[model samples]
Target: MKQQILFSFSLFLLTFSSFYYPINTASTAPASSPKLAPAPKSPSPASSKPLVPTLPDTSDSTTPDDITKILKKAKTFAILTRLLKTTEIVDNLNSQLITAKSGGLTIFAPDDSAFSNLKPGFLNSLNENKKIELLQFHILPQFVDSNNFDSLSNPVETVAGKDPLKLPFNVESLGNSVNISTGVVNATVTGVVYQDNKLAIYRLDKVLLPLDFFPSKVHASAPVAAKAPKADDHKDKSSSAEDNEDGETTQGQKKSGAVSFITIEGTRTMLVSLGVAFVAVAMI
Candidate 1:
């Protein structure tokens, strides 16, 4: 019975040892690590470029106003444009527009047809100074609108002259029509050529002929014939000539008498000298 008990216990011990050793070895083994994500790619210095700045556009800005350009665009003011350039009034008007105190100017521009209506050689007949004055006569230092024609006084002043008698003109309004009179010629404002806050231009049917160019015609009688010279007048003129001749003769006689007196005095002087020499010789 004792032998049987010992064998059974030994069998139990062997089984327990085998089971515990295998479990411990499994727990001590190393575990597998998780994989790392790849680093993000960086751009190369040679391929990368700095951003450049851009400038704003200025092409949309408004351009300056030009008088010649305006007239040229109108196409009907060719002759007037030529006159303006020849007289250099376009420059004056532009400069005045810049420095104007009243902030405006009014121009009574004559069209090509208006110039054609003038007499032949009319423009050529005017001297340089007259051409300038003719141009200035059409311009007013102040701006005047079509509606304000009645507000202006009669015989309105212009750039041509300050004296009312020289380049004097009258502005009269007949409802919608405006008439300008210079006592020499009457013209009506046909239409407005251009208008702005700084400048106003109007069309004229006829050139405003100032009194300095054309005066009122007056009939005159024939000049009185010179009164025939009277016989007494001729006699008086002849007597005056005879008296002048006598005066000349009297002057000649006085000169001759003075010459004789001088000769006699010179002879006396010579005689005295001779007498002095004779006395000296006798003393010796």
Candidate 2:
């Protein structure tokens, strides 16, 4: 009876141990594997700056304010901004563009490359008045779109100035392309930046040379077909020509003497003829 009791107690202990062992294993398996880490916090948007400097987009609407805003955003026109600031005309142009019912500005803006391509030190050498004139030359009192340039009259008067004839510019348009000729420089508009009733900005392949600034270059020195010699210079020229002829003759004689003296073929022929003569004399 004691053996039976002990066997029942042992079976009961074995069943309890089996159940507790699996529960302990299930609890320990979770602790053995790695737990995921929390994600790193992102930097604050307010503290971050853009890699490239960019002004706010102002192209959604059109106004004189857009000009200044676009200029600040456009890295291509940085040099143009510097020039406008230097000339102190940025505010004036901006004012004209923003004013109600005022004539807007048509600006032919040359790219940075075009300005750099200009002759070194050419702009720096100009006087203050010439610089102002150059700035004025690029601007027209009215906004002129590229499409209208084809039919536009020659000498489109610019804010720069005008004569009784017409404006300083001769604008020639072919299809979408337009060529601007300032008696001095001929440039084709490569592209348009901004176009509106108030302001139009066109990019040019070259810097427009103002006729007033470059009057000498406008009409090239023509090759004279013939020039009548002045009576006073006639005698002097005649004497100089005769002197040149005499000098040339003297030089020819000197060169002939130098070459003819040491010519091996001529000297050899002469020597051979003399030898034959000596032989004939001996025979005689």
**Judged by lDDT against the true structure, how good is candidate 2?**
0.72
Query: For candidate 2, lDDT tens digit of each residue in 71-176?
Result: 5554677677777888888778887776749667788877788889899998899887877788788888886755566546766888878752222688876545
What lDDT is reached at residue 103 by model 2? Answer: 65
* Candidate no. 1 TM-score: 0.53
Provide TM-scores for the models. Answer: 0.53, 0.54
Error of 2 at 208 (Å): 0.6
lDDT of 1 at 19: 78
Residue 236 CA displacement from its true place in model 1, Å:
25
lDDT of each: 0.76, 0.72
Least accurate stretch of 10 residues (summed lDDT) in model 2? 47-56
Task: List all candidate RMSDs to the true structure.
Answer: 25.9, 19.3
Candidate 1's residue-wise lDDT over 254-284, tens digit each? 9998999999999999999999999999999
